[model samples]
Target chain A: MTTAKSQRTVFFVSDRTGITAELLGKTLLTQFPGIEFLKRTFPFVDSVDKAKSVLAKIHDTAQKEDRPPIVFSTLINEEVRAALASDRALIIDLFADFIRRLETELGQESTHALGLSHGIGDELVYQKRMDALNYTLSHDDGMHTANYDRADVILVGVSRTGKTPTCLYLAMQYGICAANYPLTPDDFNELALPKPLQPQRAKLHGLTIQPERLAKIRHERKPESRYASLENCQGEIRAAEALLRQAHIPILDTSSMSIEEIAISILYGTGLIKRVKT
Target chain B: MTTAKSQRTVFFVSDRTGITAELLGKTLLTQFPGIEFLKRTFPFVDSVDKAKSVLAKIHDTAQKEDRPPIVFSTLINEEVRAALASDRALIIDLFADFIRRLETELGQESTHALGLSHGIGDELVYQKRMDALNYTLSHDDGMHTANYDRADVILVGVSRTGKTPTCLYLAMQYGICAANYPLTPDDFNELALPKPLQPQRAKLHGLTIQPERLAKIRHERKPESRYASLENCQGEIRAAEALLRQAHIPILDTSSMSIEEIAISILYGTGLIKRVKT
Candidate 1:
């Protein structure tokens, strides 16, 4: 590929939120590390007119960039998908490609529905997700210790070790009721599980971070505080790891992991993936 | 398909979290409403041995169910993918199909690396997502109104209208700093935008829910309270709608929309999609 062609515009178009298209498209793009993708998302393009307008935009981008754009689409409507057919852009329709093979395999025609993926498909499942979110919120950072019995998994970690966001992500994405407790200096002094978490030991998963990263995160939150000092971070991490090891709790290093990676690791380690509804 | 063949086991297999495979797989499955899919996810199957184990599990499930299973995979390693090939199950390798096409179009060879999709690819972008999550948490439910200047979008609605989760989802998924404020009975009295939100009028988006649904959600949280009464919910909805209309803020009815739907609606309506990093 020429140097100019290495920079291309990529569009993720979908009849719904376009999250699936964007995720799959971006994942594919990551394989080619040499290219720089200028990304855009056209969501809720459920009609022929909308598809036409998006195609026009893609055409404009191709003309402006002197290179054809790459389009990843999940448009379910046949007419809308047909309207988006452009020779100038390399359009990869995710659903159209897979649905044909699936139909041949299943011996059934697809519904071609617009928004079933992200739609509220099952009422009870949707309610359960919302319930999990509410439960996670009320129990964040050890706020409601009495509710530990209802939690699918309880995360034990130091502050800013990514406890809150992981709990919230588990609830939002997988409908898992994840509660987190931030281990403090007092708890580490004893090198034991907190009293309230003893009965829930089987559900406990620990997160530890490198002292340098922990200090950096803390310093961003509380500049110039002792809590953000490298020495204090090192002491807390050492004590926390010792306590987790003593209790036989599975531990994950969150130093370079993203929130999604951390959540998935905890779920797999604790056998909580079985509890995920969707 | 025969009635006995309506039920089939589906497996989402991946080298990393299996999130992309599951999401895309489930979305495709939604097209066939008549078939009942029993789904399982096998994440972090990065090696040949792990792939063999998962295939063994899949074979066992197929035999137990008296039918072949459907497997959707995003395994990037060629040897690992080859190991998972089985006649007992219909394996759909998502990356294998697309990467070939992408390679042909881009004239580049894919890295075929594992875990790049959910991994921390760019440090600055990953940190920004965490920053967005922290910002959303601190500004949740009208807290830290002083920091409204830093928000990408401000969601205004009554309690239990799906504001908090939507805000968190926007932050977590898109790295958009979203803040939410709950309109109380006091604000309904004047039918005015809250005083703190006056200067940030352009950043405002409103969420409204059906009275019946609102009452049901509230009753689940606070049963037998006057706050959960349908009549009270009706009055609040009417007043909040009037206030939002008077303020000219865009309104989204959350009666049937999922959190993803609501967040996308708000982002598109407020033109905040441009600010989304990923």
Candidate 2:
């Protein structure tokens, strides 16, 4: 059995994808550590009936738990937002709280539009993002080096040190074309920059992880293999770091960072954020 | 020269990745269609010195433009936030506005942690997301049908109907293991579910696009080829729609939708969001 004070139901409601509401709500919720928040998201809730149903669900959960729920909403439609009003829950309407101030500051009436954030705002921008995704995919893992000139940033790292996901994240989130090259055991033996990366020195950034963590990650894919040995992991990382440092390339230790953090760090370290429109 | 009222500079400042601030700020700015916002983001502004530099940059831009810049910040540190304060711009501090209300409601003090939102929260959750990304990558474009049983959702669509990016987005954002199969001419002739997909009927979702849009997209990849012809696009889309209808698979038309929108709609259509923890 759970106590009412320790357990809470939270809802993220929005007219569109509810991504902003979820992101902000989750960030705020992370502040309180002990409470367990069971989250539910209601996306595309653009109608009064949908909002009313969400309100009913909130009330039902409150009744069952003997405590009120918390609702983080980005509902732009007035009637639909009104339908979700309830005294039983802590309703934080994000847009309603900020839009009025923005209107007053900007000295204009807001369009009161729905789902503009996730919509295809500019056709050229959307196309560029799609193109960037394709570029990153085709250039993944040193698959195509002919297009290295087009890459915004090229990541050099040992396998399982977080390269592919970070590249994909850069392309997906910022529409930046990123390519990655995996440093192999053979390259470690030579302790020199890979031939293909030599010409793209200015775009190169290195990622290295702790040897224990690298071994664990590699062991997940290939258990008990020589490649997953801690000694091998340590040797490879040492060689890779030496080569990257010799070349004067910036390196990021990704042992404790998320993909978002790694991507953002690369963007800032390489000064590529200046070129990224998003 | 652009009028001062018609153009304004916008800045997204944060102690971490600045993604949440940019997302929420952009959503708010979209309401004012006539104004053009030149945007910049300053991530990792955790120190007072860094925040002061950003403030100076904002003031410089304001002076050059003869209009105050709009600053959207998610800085959690009080000293850093205070250093960023200035009368030259409209600074909308997201954390400052809502954290107080949340603290009052929860009856608890916030950890006031820097970069918690984008940080690697739980090791298991982070591992799941990385595993999901690896799964989606390996299953891309029907590469590994042997793992269809493990997929959360299998997307079937003709080439260039926005399958690959949508799959990547679902995996990266929601940690959903999405697999996509590109429907070819042979599949259209059979008008039956692919052999590998027959057992995974419950996980199947279909994507369609307007013939003109499909033609344009194909043309971008392989210009002047028969694959980019309008006749071929129309034939493929019609056959794909008919086949999906026969299978009773839910379909989404991706003519004007963004990748985020397409991904969210698919999650809702397939009820996969229930399985996704994040």
Best by TM-score: 1
Report RMSD (Å) for each prediction in the order shown: 1.8, 2.2
- Residue-level lDDT tens digits of model 2 in A1-278: 33355877899999999889999999988888867889988989999999999999999998998878999999888899999999999998888868887777777778888868887877888788888889999999988998899998999988989999999998877788989999987787675798999999988999999999999999999999999999999988998999999889999999999999999888876778776656
Q: Please give, for residues B129-169, the per-residue lDDT of candidate 2 as tens digits.
A: 88989999999999999988889999999999989999999
Writing each residue's lDDT as its tens digit, candidate 1 over B189-244 gives 77678899999998889999999999999999999999999999999999999999
What are the runs in model 2 whose C-alpha is more than 4 Å off? Answer: A1-5, A189-191, B1-5, B63-66
Reference-based TM-score, model 1: 0.96
Query: How far is A205's C-alpha from truth in model 1 (Å)?
Result: 1.1
Docking class of 1: medium
lDDT of each: 0.89, 0.89
Extract clashing residue pairs from model 1: none
On a 0 to 100 scale, what is the lDDT of residue A144 in model 1?
Answer: 86
> Chain A only: TM-score of every candidate?
0.95, 0.95
Candidate 1, superposed: residue stretches over 4 Å from native = A275-278, B64-66, B275-277
